[model samples]
Target: MENENKIKLFLVDDDALFLKSLEIEFMENADFTIETFATGELCIAQLSNNPDIIILDYQLDGIDQTAMNGIETLDKIKAFNPNIPVVMLSSQDKIEVAVNCMHHKAFDYVVKSETAFMRLQKIISAIFEYRKMKKELNWYMDRM
Candidate 1:
């Protein structure tokens, strides 16, 4: 939670209000160095910063009709660095949509709702825990 090691979060959403709200929630409830982008292109451009996690909106055409959607952004992120975790966020709670996100290798899919912030928090925690386990496993394997 300390500034030196706070989680760096990238939030990509076309909705300014929602993006700001989500940013505020994370800032207040958790310790995250957050950067928000209104377009997927902007987010992709900043990939060099290496955010710890990316929460991308499913629909990104709100601000720009021609802009790439969340899935496209997710793909680009993966292409740049498949190791970075990307979480898809959308108002759609349909199972098919969730499955599609998983198919594209999203870390997780989160529905935009009152409980979204809490759900995201849990998902982020799980991601780090999994990473820790993987690192430990690799270390043991190296020893072996």
Candidate 2:
């Protein structure tokens, strides 16, 4: 169950250990209501739930080979709802892949490292702040 005020987040990854670690790290924060998915297709199925953000793994190996990769999944997500911010995560630091993700409208691309969790936290916080400011500005404009 999620509190009405908490930001909803969907994290999709095929690596169980990594997914669990991320879940644990984000769970420490009360501001987020996080949901984990083992596949991109599964995450896409839940898009109607309207998460504020999605953190998706770039490579969905260990699952079926037919499973959509991050870029394909991102395309589906954007088609479904372009407003949802998606953060693409990769263990490999490939410049081409990162650029492609950005070209496809990824909110950010984070390479998996010891500092990945910290970087993710910062990105999420910045997104929340930006959304808050946008909402506040919209409200003010509506009154004019």
Candidate 3:
């Protein structure tokens, strides 16, 4: 049975092949409900769907120049809902890029690699656990 409690995730990348691969990989896990978007704008437009997390590509090649890159999109997402966790993915492994993403409140910056999927899965699990703990703590605090 599909779990209604599964975390909803938005995967935004301009690379069709990469997006499909991610969708397939994430779909293997029952804990995630994945939604794919080809551009940051499309993803942002659907923020009303209220995904629990977002995996956004740092470089949106072939997309319109006006379209937001990962950092810009991340800023918009945070402005819209700071609580929603965003993970930035990029082929570029520059420390500066990773720092920029962190500065914009990215939950994590992942370099695209053969191990990227495994790393992302682990991060997702950690995020969920952390959120659950925070919720429980808040509940206890409210009662106290």
Q: What is the lDDT of residue 19 in candidate 3?
A: 91
Model 2, range 1-144, lDDT digits (tens) per residue? 447788899999999999999999888854688899989999999999999999999998668898999899999999999999999999989999899999999999999998998999999889989999999999999999
Error of 2 at 61 (Å): 2.7
Show where candidate 1 strays beyond 4 Å.
Answer: 1-3
Candidate No. with top TM-score: 1
Count: clashes, candidate 1:
0
Q: Sort the predicted structures by lDDT, highest score first.
A: 1, 2, 3
Residue 107, model 2, lDDT: 97
Candidate 3, residues 1-144, lDDT tens digits: the string is 565688899999998999999999898855688889999999999999999999999988656777778888899999999999999999999999999999999999999999999999999889989989999999999999
- Candidate 2, residue 41: the lDDT equals 94
lDDT of 1 by residue, 1-144 (tens): 366698999999999999999999999998899999999999999999989999999999998899999999989999999999999999998999999999999999999999999999999999999999999999999999
Give the best candidate by lDDT.
Answer: 1
- Cα error, candidate 2, residue 97 (Å): 1.3
Model 3 shows how many backbone clashes?
0
Question: Considering TM-score, which of the candidate structures 1 and 3 is the better prediction for this target?
Answer: 1
Q: Model 1 Cα displacement at 7 (Å)?
A: 0.9
